[model samples]
Target: MTAAATAATVAPVRSSAGGNAASLPAMRVAGLEFRNPVVLASGTAGFGMELEDVVDLDAVGGICTKAVSIAPRTGNPALRVSEFAGGMINAIGLANPGLEAVKRDYLPWLPAHHPGTRVFVNVVGNSVDDFATVVEAIDGMPGIDGFELNVSCPNVKAGGLEFGADLQALAALVSAARTRTTRPVFVKLSPTLGTGVTDAARVAVDAGATGLTLVNTMPGLVIDTQARRPKISFGSGGISGPAVLPIGLLATWRVSRALPGVPLIGLGGVSTGDDAIQYLMAGASLVGVGTAALRDPRAPERIARQMRRWAEREGVNDLTTLIGTLQWPS
Candidate 1:
């Protein structure tokens, strides 16, 4: 959709100087309501506890854990990530404490979390059953508010788009895990697959996804032009940074239009309040910051501040009213 259409669909922001974003009406995703619309991206925020002091944890929308596997993973070799033109490439290979350890270590620490803060655990699996196991295991864990299925990782052997490669596979993964718990499921998608996001998003919902997070990092690679070798040890990695903001906006807008009732969480290269506003205007009900948060854990608050200023400038009243307002220019 054109930017002009996006503008037309959203309600103009009605300004109130010195407004407190926290005082705005709450936003909900899959039955989980947040004080605001900011979420700490999965990988960038770790298990959601590391930045408690820097951020008023209880005030933010939610937190998602770094991607976790069914079993412990050592991750990629050293030099697994490298900076590029407008983003960074990473092949971290979903490094995490795995399910068992998460239950033993991460779970215990979660209950002590501030009650107002919502936590979502991200689960990844190589096969249908693997995902079910992880989801079932994490269900009802002391403090987890929801589960986000990570479908953007690469499959070592499949010459496909990983969990997102095929709709049948994605549906199966969702179907298997949906039966295991009552916690809401948010399917994390990828931008690499391009327009396929629409189909994948719908399929996930039909299979039982309560919400959608668009997107996972776009796959990328950095080469040492002088040395004639790849910059990352894993060769190719996921790309994320400001460069992805536009694409992320488009993806979020499209999905929101296609699935008007399901909640959509936007992520990709968001570094400023304007970026968050752009996502809002494009139809994202909630926005997640990854790379920027990695650089500065307090970035979410900074973005929230920026959002208040921008909303006032734009004449927008309730930000949630801006969702799916995007349209094609006449």
Candidate 2:
């Protein structure tokens, strides 16, 4: 079926931003309601607990925890991150304390500290079964709202991008994960995949993905001229921050247009409220703050405030009205 045909199968569901939009910042995705549309992107926010002292965790919509595997991960070697002109490059290799550790150590702290906030675990693995195993392990853990599959890591099994780039593999992975959990499933797509993102989105939704995370960082490389070696320990890393904003916006537009019914959590170079608004206009149900949060721990709270101000100024009583409202010229 064609993209349009497939999209028509489901109707667009607008989120309920509370009865009086002026008072609340709520949004819904796949029947799950969020306090707002601003979310802390996975990997950048640690487990959402690390920033408890720096910012109000309950101020934003939700938090996506760092990618976790069935077993603990040491992550990439030294020099895992490097800065450049427009953005930063990172090859963290999905480092985490593993599934059991997260549930035992981190999960208990969430409800005590930030009871109102929603938590989504970012699951990473090598094979399809690995993804399923991780999902099954954390399926009913308290304080966890959903799962966001990280299929774009560039330094892991199958080179990370392989699963996201291949339609069959992506479908199988999503399907396996779906069976293992009753909670919502979101597939994070790689920006480097180009047209393959559209195919992957379709297969993922059909296989049981509740929503989509529009992009992961694009692959990049930086060289240390004097040393004649890659700046990052890994030869290449994922490029993020303002440099990929346009790429992320375009990808969000394309995929959202192709899969209108699938909610999207958009991110990439989002540092301000204006940037978050752009993602909403492009069809994202929610916007994610990643690298920006690294620069300012309170970035998500600030962005949420800005979004509210922008909505009031534009006479947008309900912020949801701004979503997918972009007009195309004749």
Candidate 3:
């Protein structure tokens, strides 16, 4: 299918509540309406159903499942996650049950249980065709609200940051994936792109991305002095937590400024309602909670509750007004 044709067919599925209200914290992004602005970042939430016993799934704005590839992956070796002073590093290697298993096991269960919660699948692959294949597999699957493309994943074919670092490659990947599904496509970017984040945002949007997810985990390493070895199984892993809050904020600000009116989902180091507000002010329509959930499975719901309290306390009737309201020193 052509990009234009796919775009034309894709429409935002309205919430049961319908349009946003001034007194509510609801938001609409790229046709998907969220009850709140706090989303569970992919990889941390484990396909959106794993936390049912501990978390109130319907409480958060949405849930992004871990990266789903065309084939099942075992991920990295042991010690997939390790903590630092301010944050944590992980090299889970996108371990997932593959698309077929997801469709059979998870999709049906979601709608029957958490009907109100929005579910976005995080799609990852080693090549542009790989991404397209995965998206095609889940195109019309029930209970899936949208997709967050993990373009920040290293492209084995092109090498060197793969699809994310190269504008042409990123556009091609997005365009290919766009043809596969009419669902909203959110491109998850890398902070390592620096000023390139703006360029990437433009390319992704122009290539048919419905929205952008600013600032995936930055790469980092933890060392063990006594063992003279890296802490995690992988020599280097993505860093996430409080340490990346400023990085995520700056990326959101830059991308929002560069691409006005485009929906953005900001993540990295968002553990509190205040942190979420910072992201909103910086230009993120929605904020994602990841590492904090690792520490406490109920963190996303807690953060959302706190955000609501904060909004009420400040007398901000509408949370949407907070977007891009940052005041800078002239």
Task: State residue 245's C-alpha deviation in candidate 3, in Å.
Answer: 0.2
Q: Write the per-residue lDDT of candidate 2 for residues 1-330, one digit (tens) a residue.
A: 222233222223344434332224566665666778888999998887788888677778788888988899998999999888888999998889988998899767776787667888899888898899989988877778889998764324455557887777888888899889878888999987787788888888888888889889988999999999999999998999999999999889988888876788898999999999999999998899999888898788888888888988888867777778778678
lDDT of 1 at 130: 84
Q: What does candidate 1's lDDT look like per residue over 32-145, in tens digits? A: 567677888988777755676676565566788888898899889989878877988888888998888878877556458666567888988787788899998889676788
Q: Estimate each model's TM-score.
A: 0.89, 0.90, 0.92
Candidate number with greatest lDDT: 3
State the lDDT of candidate 3 residue by residue for 1-330, as single tens digits: 433233322122333543432113567766767878888999999976788898777778788898899899999999888999989999999999888998899766777788777888899998999999988888788878889999877788775566888898999999999889888888999999899889888888889998889889999999988999999988899999999999999999999898767788999999998999999899888899999999998788778778877888999877878889999879
Comparing 1 with 3 on TM-score, the higher-scoring candidate is 3
| Every candidate's lDDT | 0.78, 0.82, 0.84
Task: Kindly report which residue stretches of model 1 are placed more than 4 angstroms away from their true locations once superposed.
Answer: 1-24, 53-56, 154-161
Q: What TM-score does model 3 achieve against the real structure?
A: 0.92
Residue pairs of candidate 2 with colliding backbone atoms: none
Give lDDT: candidate 1, residue 325: 67
CA-only RMSD, every prediction:
5.4, 3.8, 3.5
* Best-first order by lDDT: 3, 2, 1
* Candidate 3 local Cα displacement, residue 19, angstroms: 18
lDDT, candidate 3, residue 248?
A: 97
Report RMSD for candidate 1. Answer: 5.4
> What count of clashes does model 1 give?
9
